[model samples]
Target: MKLRELALISSGINERRNPQGTIYYIGASDFVAPSLLNKLIKPSIMPSEKLEKHFLTKQDVIVLGKGHNGFVGHTIVDDSKPMVASSSFMVLRDFHVKVLPKYIAWYINLESTQQELRSYSRGTALPSINRTILGDLEIKIPPLKIQKQIIEIDELKKQESKLTTQLDQLKTIQLELLLKNKIKNYEQ
Candidate 1:
């Protein structure tokens, strides 16, 4: 099914900053990966009432709409505070019952899917995927049970990668300590 058929695709808000604003703004730089976002620090204040409609929820999936590197991120905002993505992102919400938001984000973040998305980008300097192109992109929907399993496996892979990095660092430190001890004994 096409993405538009599964969820409502809309451009993020294009508003100026307001000092007295209350909404948190998420920009392309905020993403650490296609599925992760950095902790919110300072919030962008937009002095517009229309921003209420753009407020992000946990179920919303944000896609980098304008750039050479296109990626998608699942929204991780605190529900206590209102938040909205910047104009550089396209928000997908109101997903169909047959699909899960995280599953959609995971599928899009795949290397193969990312390559396909890049192919649809336009412009030379700052290639971008317009709303129509993004909406028309195909999405493969699996059974809910399978979708849950995929998400769980993907999470485990991420955890494994992180743990492996830590282990490598520890091994390096251990080797360095051993070398230092050997040098000290030889000097003695």
Candidate 2:
């Protein structure tokens, strides 16, 4: 289905904070969990007025605003907890059951969307996309089952990345030890 035809709506911000009443600040390094946001740095807090209508949920799709314009395109919140966002972010609401949130999020970050988003940005000094421009964006989505299959593949890729990092760290340690031993032998 075409993205415009599918749930064409904007996201809402949270009017309240977590039980601890902390406002989550999203940084460039925040670990936006795959399917679920596992963790993030609580850099600062925002007033309810500042985030009155930007709350996002498990299925809501988010896009980056401000400095990173069109770079970190989109992501779906799989976490159960309600989280608020900074002004430099926007959300797309689900208006239909036909489209899966994860798939839409993935589609928005694709090379095609990147091109569209880049073209959409309008500013002489700093590029930024308005809500209307974002809502106007288009995407293609498969059936629900296919969406699930894609999600599964994405999860696997995430796991593979983690394992690769671990393996690289171990190999680096081994190489460092071998080099240290060779130097010690040469000194003798």
Candidate 3:
């Protein structure tokens, strides 16, 4: 089924230079997976009226629009609250129950899917996927139970990746210490 049938694809807030009433803003680069908004980027205030429609929730998926082809399909699962995406992102929300948000996010971030997105993108300098392009994309929905299992497995893989990185850092530090001690011994 088309992505629009599963979720609403909408443009994000167009930030105003100046306006009345304050609302939080989130640009495409402000988020990192597994990290909440507070640490990645600070929220800036825009006019509430300007932001009324772009408010996001934990379920929202924010995809980068205008960027290098490598980043065109880059996306973030919006686990953060009380914020809105800037014009650089296409916000997806109000997902249908037949699909899990994480599952769809995983599918779209897949290398194959990203390649397809790049093909559909437009621009001479900074390629971007507009709502129409995003809306037409298709997704296969598995049983909800299967989707849950997939999500669990995906989370485990992400955890394992993080642990592996930590272990590599420790190994590097250990090697550095051993080399430093050996050099000192040689000098002595």
Best by TM-score: 1
Across residues 101-163, which tens digit of lDDT does each residue of candidate 3 receive?
A: 778877787788888888988987878888988888888788999988987897899899989
What are the per-residue Cα lDDT tens digits for candidate 1 across 1-188?
99999999999887777667667787888777555667654576854667788888877888887776665556553456688888998899999999998898888788888888888888879888878988888988989999999999998998999899999999999999999999999999
Better of 1 and 2 by TM-score: 1
Clash pairs (backbone) in predicted model 3:
none
Rank ordering of all candidates by TM-score, starting from the highest: 1, 3, 2
Off by over 4 Å in 2: 1-4, 8-21, 27-29, 32-40, 46-53, 68-82
Question: Ranking under lDDT, best-scoring first?
Answer: 1, 3, 2
TM-score of 2: 0.75
Q: Return the TM-score for candidate 1, rounded to 2 decimals.
A: 0.87
User: lDDT per model, in order?
Assistant: 0.82, 0.63, 0.73
lDDT tens readout by residue for model 2, 26-101? 4334535433444645525545664645555556666665554454544654444435655566766755786777
- Distance from true position, residue 140, model 2, in Å? 0.9
Error (Å) of candidate 2 at residue 177 is: 1.7
Better of 1 and 3 by lDDT: 1
